[model samples]
Target: MLGLCMGLAGVVWAELPAPSFTLAWTHTIEKIRWEEDYRVTPSGLLLGEARIKGSGAGMEIPDGAELREGAWHYQSHLPPLQPLRLGRTPEAGDYQLCIDQRCRPLGDWVGPPQADRPALELWSCETGSGAG
Candidate 1:
């Protein structure tokens, strides 16, 4: 009976789901943009593969770029990363992006939120273009 109960418990544990959240960021410099998305769990970790995409002529991932970041802590905490933690996720409605301390509302994205696909286009910024 003990062995049987243990086996059943294992089955139940296997079905438990981990709390999760999705995060996407876009860092635009000059005319180029860098973006990344991660599926994070309660433990503040990437659940699976992360999605990455960018648009530019000659740009590389910055030195501090990371899939798991401190912002996740703020994002998971009771208070979301809103006015305090700008450039992250929004509180409600439409996605957004921040650049040089300025933020703008974004429309629906074009493709899937995947590495190759990516989520919506979110927002855009230009270095002195004044066209954003």
Candidate 2:
């Protein structure tokens, strides 16, 4: 009985925190806009451009530059301001995105970037609830 209990505990330890809803990767915008240049440090954080595609005039951004970036929120924690560069494209894949300081359609992405194939699925837990 003790061995079985230990085995169960191990499984739980290896599991990631459960999320309520999973945010699916709808599309990738091919470049955004930023008025001023931003910089973020390296503390397990990434700095790049957020490319959003599909809009009325073909493509558009919140501002009107080619890159715009705010604090990236992961799960519910905001590390630091990461630099938002231009040109670099994130590989397509499912990622967990959450709202942080700045509010926008594309939220901060979690996990490694994926390719343009295989729809990306982001997970998030509902407020005042647990993942069952």
Candidate 3:
């Protein structure tokens, strides 16, 4: 089993059962839906795949991406991310975190967004120490 930590500024707020999961949201600027699939590993989180409903500013279709079912999909070749930063704002809407085919608002895991702490950090719990 893999543990995922959700936190703000090095203070953990929650942990989730994370063998693999998907993080999805609508682009604040383009309003297009985007989804990324990630696999939890001992070292970090591996970005396995990504898909976008449409392309717009900052949403360029990457090389090797293929259009399928009205969306662009591609595999991510980047190195494992030790910590993935997600910026949260009341206006931008909640990020959907999907695990085991069930989706919920990210706040369901990390608690409500704090005005002072504007970013939520996610990483494999094996990689860092934080109280939950």
Candidate 4:
């Protein structure tokens, strides 16, 4: 009985499935794009990576670029609050192929994951709300 009780407790504390989703944003004038693949644990910890793509002027991803409160801010080495030209590069795999401190967009899941993909909830700072 005690063992069963402990097992139940453990199950109660089991981590929640990470929320899997893809995030994206872009700016045409800057010719830059940004997309991030992330998984958020039930504890609210988000783990993911991103890729940046460019067309005309080349993609520029600043050092301080980060996703804070659901907004990608290319703050360093780029303008503030501007889109980072989000895109995907299947060739780069799990890394950003940067040349001259810049690289074409790398692996960033777009559209949807798979047919069996989990539902996605998009959080937008601009809207200050989440949408499915």
Candidate 5:
């Protein structure tokens, strides 16, 4: 009986799920043409990597170029979010951001569709809030 109880407890503990992250906020943009700009730090470095994906005109994405090969996939490691700007001023939004332990967007999912792909939008979020 003692062994069975311990085994059951171990199983339950192992089955427990990990905590989730949430998005802080999101920003909608009209377009992202020209050189993709990102935030930079004082030492001139990227804050995080900016991964861009979607289908559009004249967007050539070679096969096996990335984990997902849709109509387009352009990714770059961006500098920290301190000295970043979008054109004349900064363009961004804040939404809660979170991540599932098992799910990876670009790594796990297929690329965007071919036709009727809308203009790209940048989404920013914090961790844990049930937002995507």
Candidate 6:
């Protein structure tokens, strides 16, 4: 089965079951919620959709975005990413990783960030190593 690999400083720390997942976080300045859906592909990770509850500075809706259910939703036109990097500082707060309608703090999968490793790297995992 496909999975996700979470790493710190070039070392794999943990793995989680993931064919697809939604990453949700709050905007530090606007305090509004933002979510992005990503799918794991053999080539890389593909960003499928994005949505934001309300909007403010640096949160302008995209050209083709539709406002639905009190949120602006849109599809990303960008290509797949080989790996995604996320900040894990107190300032950035915690990110909620959702899969199959359940959610959990990202730190639960990879553990809290240390002073030396304040960022987490995520990528598609095809090999069986560490897959849950």
lDDT of each: 0.27, 0.26, 0.85, 0.33, 0.27, 0.82
lDDT of 3 by residue, 6-118 (tens): 88566677887677999999999999999999998888889998999988899898999999999999999989887899898887888999998788999887766667768
Best-to-worst ranking by lDDT: 3, 6, 4, 1, 5, 2
- For candidate 5, the C-alpha RMSD (Å) to the true structure equals 16.5
Off by over 4 Å in 1: 1-26, 45-132
Residues 1-132 of candidate 6 have per-residue lDDT tens digits of: 677777855577877767999999999889999999999887667999899998799988889999999999999988887678888876677889999978898888776656666888888875465542
Worst 10 residues of 3 by lDDT: 123-132
Q: Which stretches of model 4 miss by more than 4 angstroms?
A: 1-18, 55-59, 62-132
**Clashing pairs for predicted structure model 6, backbone only:** none
List, residue by residue over 1-132, the lDDT tens digit for candidate 4: 000000011122111122344444454456355655544332322424555664345565556666565544542222221111222232222223232343432223223223332222222111112211
What's the residue-level lDDT of 48 in candidate 6? Answer: 91
Model 5 lDDT at residue 38: 32
Q: List the residue pairs that clash in candidate 3.
A: none
Output the TM-score of candidate 3: 0.90
Cα lDDT of model 5 by residue, 53-98, tens digit: 5424554444444534332334554433322222111233222222
Measured with C-alpha atoms, the lDDT of residue 131 in candidate 1 is 23
TM-score (C-alpha) between model 1 and the true structure = 0.23
TM-score of each: 0.23, 0.22, 0.90, 0.29, 0.24, 0.90
lDDT of 5 at 34: 23
lDDT of 2 by residue, 30-65 (tens): 332222211222231222334443333454344543
